[model samples]
Target chain A: MKNALQTVLALLGEDYDSILQAWLETQKAEGVRRPDLFSDRESRRQLGDILRGLGEGISRSDLSEGIALDADSWTDLRATLDEVTQERVERGVSPSEMATFILAMKQPVFARLRERLAADPTRLIEEITQFSRVVDALAMHTNEHFIEARDQVIERQRAEMMELSTPVVQLWDRVLTIPLIGTLDSMRAQEVMENLLNAIVEHSAEVVIVDITGVRVVDTQVAQHLLRTAAAVRLMGAEAIISGISPKIAQTMVELGVDVGEVTTRPTIRAALAHAFRRVGFSIEKVENARG
Target chain B: MADTASVYLVEHVLLVAIPDNITDTEIMSLQEELSTRIVSDGARGVVIDIAALEIVDTFVGRVLAQLSSMARLLAAETFVVGMRPAVAMTLVELGMDLHGSRTALTLSHALRALRSEGLA
Candidate 1:
């Protein structure tokens, strides 16, 4: 078994350029390679690094010891795998293609071992089985790493959207306006309320106009969230005026029996702003054109 | 702890400054003292200066709300002033807004609001 692995490692160390070329061809034949997404220079450098790392890693591992990616010898291999996975995830590479990239190397390595040890069938089988196990573990590792990188990207985007979704703008000395858009889940609702309350305190706002014209739907859960936000605004000693209650939403609320209690709802944002101006003691009058 | 929340007469309004390290017993005693002074001192309003309080949990929020109503029953208005932004957010999140309890940005604002309402 040792002799068989020694021959395979020797072939890996001496002729990786040919093996890597063969690996790329196999992946292309399987229709997993994306030449459009990857420049030739980048593809060669990335695959070349992995081939080097794997050769160094397998040289220190015992063939019968099973897969130990945590082993000191596999450090280079693990690091290379991590880099490739992160790059692929950022480039929008399909996960199946990532896993297949590692798996395709098996065909090239097996062919190299066959040509060197085909005179002895038992040795060829030993090398083939040992090399297969190593490739399978590496493939599985690549799949998991890709998933982790993708999860991180999703988590960051969600955080960014949360920040962008809730913005409290101070429209007047003691008045703030929040124009809400999109769906209002419970978590997002909580975020909105927290941001509004903090802004009220920051600006010492006495009245706040929560405009929901951009909201597409007003389900029962959404109504509850809006009500809770209104209650929170009042609790902060600021008056809440819900504006832009579309006719459809009004009907839905009435049908759902969702009572807004003391929350003042207006027909449009203009009306709500007018009410806010009134609460803050701002009277607007249209002057006749003096030029006329 | 018992004397952490101090109530004193400022003009016709009773000004109460609650400390951050005030204990539950201190709050109960303070409430008793405040109620007594509202009648005895003939104050038209009570100004709770909670700027000294760093954290206002549900207990403090509910207490302020109850105190407001109790003061109203005794012919006096209660105003909580100088509430920190974080404390206000926590009160709202806890679903306790100290409803019926008026709030002001500063001690002077609470006093002015209280006095204006007294005249009205």
Candidate 2:
């Protein structure tokens, strides 16, 4: 009976029911025998051969049974079986045994079937699971790549802006001269104010000379920013001196009604320094050093 | 608008020549362009030529002060030139600080001022 069952299983391709029944019968025959052989790779391999011998019809039946497994149960079973197969592989199991172990692992077997069908792909239930996994992995990889690239670009921009904003030299003991060249917007204005305030605190400057001969025109918002900056400087116990006023900017200021009365204006940094020096009780005079 | 206007670059002075009837947009654009140029070229100072200005209002005065501060950040000096008597008086009447911030009477005076102050 055991031989017959083995022959039938080999011919039928180890359909789950046949394999389960044969193992049960073998246990009955052996009286106090353990059922551990059912899970053994060699035993599974022999059973697989028996089922395969049962021809194409038996193989179809096995396939149908696999499809009949509940989706959730099938997933759990596949995960457990794959873990076991991985453990076996790590233990250096023989290739043949590994193959049988992998075959018993539903995930790998399903993956192979999916690959075969994907070449001529269909919307079958099994194919859906495989496709979803591939999509999920691709999405995760893409999101990670995008975030990394975005962060790198932001870091680079921040560094560049900082370099552009750094002040290089101080012109006087109580007066610090900063040359501004570029369009002044709200963000840049804020940066300028912050930098100036910090410098004023650091140097204890009484006057801040701002030369803007490079500026072509002044808008209302920009005018407001400057007023705010001047106010901020005053609050910090320092004076803000504005040096450059283009005719175009002057006209705009008049039209816009922006007032800058509290701040001092100079035509150039030289004048601004002179004014600052005089304000601090120092005058520029020609120095003559004679040692001839 | 005139394609070209007289430009006088006094030694050590920034001369910004503007077109007649300078509009708000033009003023804003000029400020942005000049600021960028100052920072890029590391200009020491500038003198703005406002000889063509017929009206000096509050907004325009405010803008002038703003531009001066911006130029200062770039290590360049700013000077307002060609302030007409009427405009100056109007500015003063409006309580505007045209003289309080960086401003000049003429392009040459601005240059001389820059030179004298050692910021030329």
Candidate 3:
């Protein structure tokens, strides 16, 4: 019998128990003696027949009328069951399991009720009570499963986002140079911001050079991300030197009406480095010698 | 609303052939649907065929990241397929991280990679 109960519970998903519990409460409110339904085999059999009929497409209205269960009360019970089942389905529980659970609860309750039919043929109170207990258990289990599934999804999403945002390298005492090797989409922009800020603070970077020589093109959105990164660096009291302004990117910037005049740009990383050195009051004599 | 396209399953891996112009809403819906299927059936991995995509924006990148995490949660792996050179260049220029996230040059290659990793 316990195995049967477990089987039924597994099949019903989660809300079946809750629906049964609510029906029992409704029966009790109407002065029905519910406990005797489980003790009697005839009453149990009758309950089973009714549940089988319900499963076979007998409406809850018809079941209530046939069993002397209040029509209005049964309607409320059906609504609650529907609500619970929908909730379970939305949470990714299979519908077949839910149906099986409902059928399982009906079996024991109806079997007990069938036994009681000989003593008091109209007594459905005990059957309703038993159904109520089983349904409550099912509902609790279903709700727990739903919550577990939801949490698993949320946790996975959080972890994945974290992985995506994971910094490629940590900043030490040296002025780390991160070459912007590809397109500057918003997602990568946010990542660059976080990484650069952390590196600056950790290493107390005197100058951070972002070389975009490898970038093939620049759009307005990408430009905005760069500006935002520069602003973020300034807030951290560090200098951001953007180098490798390809002629194509420059043309796009102008065409897109983006004014990056305030952003210090250089033809290459070497030029940006020279500018950085000059800012620190040190002239690169090698470049001067080459020019000489 | 477009019809929910059928997912192609092969050797425990689910392949979703997404159109080039995938919207954010579509990505979100796909994420939800794929997550449900993966959990219910316990798939080995998922490969998103992006061969048709000419350009990828930030939203798409975020969605891929989300999908990767969702697949991991289901004990499945995720891979992007058919990354065009031009699109790849754009992603790099835009500062998108393509490294460490599983990627393949073709759908068949992605599947093979997953199989090699014992995920498919």
On lDDT, the candidate that comes out on top is: 1
Candidate 2 vs candidate 3: which has greater lDDT? 3
- Model 3, residue B107: what's the lDDT? 72
Candidate 2: tens digits of C-alpha lDDT, residues A1-292: 2221222224234345544445434433543122343354544553344223223322223332223222442343333333434344344444444333323323333444454455544433444453334323323333343445446657888878765754624777777866777777777776677777667657767678877776655788878767766655653445778877766777778899988776788767778888889765677777699456
- TM-scores, all candidates, are 0.82, 0.36, 0.32
The TM-score of the first chain in every model comes to: 0.84, 0.46, 0.40
Off by over 4 Å in 2: A1-147, A166-169, A285-292, B1-120
Identify the candidate with maximal TM-score.
1
Tens digit per residue, CA lDDT, model 1, B19-51: 888877778788888889989999888889888
lDDT of 1 by residue, A1-292 (tens): 3643687789888998898889889988987777887877778888899989988888887767677887898999999999988988898999998988889999988888889987998989988998888889999999999999999999999999999988899888898999999988889888898899788878888899999999989999999889878877775567899998999899999999999887899989899989999987898898888565
Q: How do the candidates rank by TM-score, highest first?
A: 1, 2, 3
lDDT order of candidates, top first? 1, 3, 2
The per-model lDDT (C-alpha) reads: 0.84, 0.57, 0.60
For candidate 2, what is the DockQ? 0.02
Q: What TM-score would candidate 3 get against the native?
A: 0.32
